[model samples]
Target: MFNDMMHILTTQSGDILTALREHILLSLMAIVIATVIALPLAIALMNHRRAGEWVLQVAGVIQTIPSLAILGALIPLVGIGTVPAVIALVLYAIMPIFQNAYAGLTGIDPILLEAADAFGLSKRFKLFRVQLPLALPMIMSGLRIAMVMIIGTATLAALIGGGGLGTFIMLGIQTNNNAELLIGAILSAALALAFSWGIRLLSKLSVRRIGVLLVSAVVIIGGFAGYRAINQPAGTITIAGKLGGEPEILINMYKDLIQADNPKMDVQLKPNFGGTTFIFKALQGGQVDVYPEFTGTVLQSLVKVKGSISHDKQTAYKQAKTLIKQQHNLDLLEPMKYENTYGLAVRQADAKRYHLQTTSDLLRQSAQMTAGFDPDFYKLSDGYPGLKKAYGLNFKNIVQMESSLRYEALANKQIDVTDAYTTDPQLKQDHLVTLADDKHFFPPYQGAPLVNDKTLQKYPGIAKSLNKLSGKITNQDMIEMNYQVTVQHKKAAQVARTYLVKRGLIQ
Candidate 1:
């Protein structure tokens, strides 16, 4: 395991370092921007105490909004990538900076203030020369707090295509790769420590420390700017994916095919996006051109199809494709040869103890056990609701949590039963027994490429290129590839490329 970890770290050194750099730079930028905006506001509010307090209250409200919620809200307005992420960081940071700045300015020695006034010094002159200097330490403390928050919160930025160590963290969860998760967590913690140290060093108010901080900031920012300037590629088609191993492989498969066919095709993979709703919004808004989606997801969630859906994969795909084209101006291509529908699963021990062979069997024991499910499953008509109705299940509890964490929760016996995708590598790896839906509640979830109509019109080759992936991957092929990524800890891109090569789809 140590050797394997070392190999992963070495091979991913470039990505790790780049992620670290981006994390630090983003935190620094948010802190600096917050300080710049809040310092003056704090100084002004110091004179008008009541109004200042009210303004601080507003900043406090902004801080109370969950970072991810803030990110989601910003998507429609600011779009995805770095800008929205940075804006969220800044919003989270404002309260601390404002509070400390106000406190620092107001806490100045009265005698010092009286002396400055008696000297007939202008208010602005006094603030700049005396009060501001004295309050620097307190302001620096607030900046430190803000920096810490930004560093932690910035991890969520990856959800919106904003790159950072969070990229690995998100990918790790998606693929069930513990090493990648550890790397992301360890490096993020390290970055927080390093940033806190730098902030502390600068708080001493030494000229050399300040100079060092300034120079470091400049180099980091300038380096990123230069990198971006030099690496801007033309004619790139942005393909997005929800955060998961399947999406990771699918998107990479698209990139692999595109690049192999035309090295200059510039297929950009935007992984770690939020959920179906967010991705759908992004596609409709033109933030992304193409993405991998499930036919059932399109039919039920996007198209809002009423009643029990088609069980036949081909029929479902055709219906979903037609509805999506008419409604969302999107095209659903021919599906891959796999179905990744959701199903209820429990530990092997539970299965044996309850003699569970189907949803009906589990339903009999449901009253005594606590069930865990993803939030989406809880809400989806074809998910818990439909299953509960079909099997007449009534559990002791139904805890909603992150889908990625569901397997761990189940393995640890934190949840007696949880919903899982049929293609999830963890299901087999963890030895969980899936309960058959004898009542036939869930619809077929055939995987396919969902492309924007505008993109297809512009780059006809994209449809042609992506369609080549149609009917390629089988159910067993998907399971193995998912295992290779989630259990074997191989990179998704490498796994996709290997599959293509094995199938003679690419050289």
Candidate 2:
């Protein structure tokens, strides 16, 4: 584990550095925003005990909600990306900052106020000259607390398309790669300590110096953000991928194909962006230009077809393509050859004990078993719900977990069963068995590139370039590629490029 992490650190230095910068920038933005709102509000409510308690209680309530839950709630309102993430982090930060500021301002010695009154000082003069400087240390103490909290919470942001060191964390967890997880976790802890030290220094300085430091932080962040914006080329094509190894691999293939054909075109890849709903919303909102999707997913989740879905691959693809074009006005390109449909996997012990050879066989003992399914599988029509309806399954408990975590849980026997995909590399590991879908509740799920129509209109070559991969990735081929990435710890981009080159799809 240590060697793998060190190898990743050495080989993926550029990615780690980029993620560190992104994490720092996000944490700083939240800290600054929280300070701006909290300090002023605390000062305003310092004398109003009743009103101040009410406000503090509200911040406390917001703080109690899990950071990931807040981000999920904000998806429909603000959509996924940095904006919602920062907003969630700011919410978590306000409680500590405001409480400490209010306490500091209100708890000052009465002798100081009396002295100021003897001098006939204005309220504003007393605040800036007398009260604020004395309160600086206490207020900065709160900032240090808030800063540490923000830096830690910011890691969850990557789960919802908010990029940061959390991306490394999520990638590591999904691929079962200890190195990736360590990079994210260690850096996050380091950032919190660094900022805490910086805040400690600010507390000792005069109020004026603190103000200068705060302003400088904002300026530096703004400058960095502006520089990226300025450098982003016109007609830049942005591609996104859903969470997990498969989409990441596919999106890399898409980028490599486009670059191989049009060397001049600018392409950006947002891997592990999010789930089906979030990424689809990004496409509709023009946050992304393209992403990979499964045809069965479209019918089952997005479209929610009124009747039985087609069993045949081409038939299902055509149906999905037509409906998607009609409903969304987006293009669903030609699909790859493989069908990565969902399946139920269980521990070897559970299989033997319950005689679970097929989905229907689970009916006899399912009510006694605990099932841990991916969150997406829990919600999709072709997943747990459909399986339950078809096989009359009634598990004692249903737990929602992410794909990689579910696999670990299954391996540990923490869960009796979980949702597994046909091409999942984790499924290749021993001690787990995929139950036969005798009822065939799930439809064929062919992977395809779903592109925005406007984007295709502008970059017409993308469709042609991407089409070269149609009918290319077979079921075994995808399993091998995914294994290379998730199990062997190979870079997804390198794996993708190698496949494209060997297949003569790219030079």
Best by lDDT: 2
The per-prediction CA RMSD against the true structure, in angstroms, equals 4.2, 4.5
lDDT of 2 by residue, 131-150 (tens): 99988888988998999989
TM-score against native, each model: 0.84, 0.84
- Residue 56, model 1: Cα distance from true site in angstroms: 1.3
Model 2 has an lDDT value of 0.86
Lowest summed lDDT over 10 consecutive residues: which window, candidate 1? 206-215
Give the range of the ten consecutive residues with the poorest summed lDDT in model 2. 427-436
In the range 1-507, model 1's lDDT, one tens digit per residue, is: 567567769877887898887787788778876766887799888989899989989998888888877887888887787778888998989899889989999999999999999999998789878887888888888988888889989998888888899988887776656678888888888888888898887777653456466668667766876788599686668999888777989999998887777887777888777678777777887778888999988987899675667877777888899889988889998788888888888999889988998888886789999999999899977678878887789999989998778899999999999998888888778888878777767888889999889888988877777778888887668878888876766788999999989988889
